[model samples]
Target: MALQVGLVGLPNVGKSTLFNAVSQAGAEAANFPFCTIDPNVGVVAVPDERLTRLAELAASKKVVPTAIEFVDIAGLVAGASKGEGLGNQFLAHIREVDAICNVVRCFDDDDIVHVSGSVDPARDVEIITTELVLADLATVEKRLDRANRTARTGDKDAIRERDVIEALRDHLGDGRVARTFPGELPPAVARELSLLTAKPVLYAANVAEDDLGQGGEARGNPYVEVVRKLAEEEGAEVVVISAQVESELAELAGDERQEYLDDLGLDRSGLERLIDRAYQLLGLLTYFTAGPQEARAWTVPSGSTAPRAAREIHTDFERGFIKAEVIAYDDYDRLGSEAAARDAGRLRIEGKEYVVADGDVIHFRFNV
Candidate 1:
């Protein structure tokens, strides 16, 4: 699956710093990782321990993990709806992404000047939300104009569309986002508009390193609390991160990296948490394939059937239309290998209707 999340915030929110860490991690993951889909995009491997363990069990020569793309959108400013400070370009970039990760500045520092002079999560969120809502309002109005013209022909479908568009117009006019609008729009119209505000969003509270939680409780940054509360109201997820920590972690490897995290009393870096949350935001899950040649992770939207997941590996796998060999990760860990799992009756044959599960080890039996 191609999970793409766009990072957007006003200047000086550490968006660029966060992207730099992602870029380095992507580059270090593999030779073919999509570290540079474009000037501002980086793709990193989805962190999964099962993939590594499977590789060990299979004695695989290589390991490949599913990747997610992060796009660094242009900085936003007031009047983005009217194209101020390249606002139009920024909004366009966001429209092309699957989800949005708004990096909000929560850490205060005299050296790092905030665009608004002082950090205020409420004001920062409002500015971005207003811009997106304004842009969506523009889109709804244009679409309504065309729908109204079509409705003049007395076409029932056009009339219905015009009514729907009018409703959307009013909703946006009330300073509401499309995602929060009551009920759902027709699928076709929704796709046509591709309203930016409709995309799922999460807030990354970029705090100072010292303010980040070590292992358990939060370090008590009032800024993070504000972001968390705002995210709660918006029905969005929040990931507290320190760009400074991620940046330093990106430059270390092996025991050095582990040592750094240990000293900080953290098990993983913030980028890892961000990616995991992003996956949840998009309703994604990971499954695995293991062999002597390689052990790999593949992502699929939750509730995907066996045949649908087979398509992620190759279209032919789905075309062949055969059963799948499935082994739960726990069974694999206990039995130790495919042969062992088979002998122990831990592996089962599943049909096309079988929904692929997270952490499932699958071997598709296909003819094509």
Candidate 2:
């Protein structure tokens, strides 16, 4: 399975529209503030043409692709850290996710009211980022106090924790995000804190229909450009999409959806971009396992070792480790079948130390 990614933005930024369109979960979205009070989660399958092709080649009875859980949280406000609005209630929802997808309103709509009175992508991003930073600041400060109290007992671990929390508090107090904090954090500490700002961010610039197809790059949209520049500064990715267009696309099917996308001068739906970007943001890759029974896709971190990747399938697979019979996807495609690939020596045996690569067709050899 893919990791969870949260969709967040200020009110009226088309966040729920995108979520509803992508997940088809009918997240309640209206033209007012706080319409979506509860977090709406939708599990979406990650699409891969390789899985379809492999199924055909192997004559598999079924196909299963990895999935991601998308959480649509309530809109944030300027003073959310201080419990000014519903933002505080929903910020906790974000802490449950692995990464963030920040939706920015890049379109101007006279009918849809902007929470800030006008559409300003830069300001909207700042408002949301600042709130997250402030909230994390409060969290670190509270943790630091406890750490300091424990440090008084002269516990080595407690003393080290107090030092790290102190630095984090100083960074957040200066309006700096945890992601940009100076050094690497211990994995345990990172898991314990779960700072919102520390999560990787992918920007979704919600543009108008006309702006969506402005050009191949879609840089003609001034509002989208603002978001693009901001994402660049943060070393993030920007996906240009019109939430209204996506909502309309969700109602379409088969040829109809393709025709509509062609009419929009787009080759794919924004949801595809969202899924693709989310994987990249999380540093994930996919590998496949195929047979006459089933063809399935699996998600793993980019540099995962063969045994580590096996753990994703089952802990027992890792515990009783041996070797993995692997075929490169391209080799399998050229050889036309797994048997042919093995006969042609395109299949290789990988050991525990073998690092798994993306697009590998793997069959693990293990014992309990």
- By TM-score, the best candidate is 2
- Those runs of model 1 whose alpha carbons end farther than 4 Å from true positions after fitting are 25-39, 216-219
Report the C-alpha lDDT of model 2 over 1-368, residue by residue, as the tens digit: 55899999999999999999989999999999889998999998888989889999999999999899999999999999888676789899999998999999988789999989999999999999999999998888887888899999999988887887898899899988898998666688788889999999999999888877633356678888899999999899999888888899989999999899888888878888888998888889999999999999999988999999999899999999899999999998888899999999999999999999889999999999
Clashing residue pairs, candidate 2? Answer: none
Name the regions of candidate 2 deviating beyond 4 angstroms: 154-157, 214-216
lDDT of every model, 2 decimals: 0.87, 0.90
Candidate 2: C-alpha lDDT: 0.90
What TM-score do all the candidates reach, one by one? 0.95, 0.96
lDDT computed for candidate 1: 0.87
Q: What does candidate 1's lDDT look like per residue over 1-368, in tens digits?
A: 79899988877888777888876633221112122223388888888988999999999999998999988876687798998876887788788899999999898788777777789989999999999999999999999999999999999988988988899999999999899888668899999999999999999998888887676225588888888889999899999888888889999999999999999889988989999899899999999999999999999999999999999999999999689999999899888999999999999999989998899999999997
* Candidate 1 minimal-lDDT segment of 10 residues: 27-36
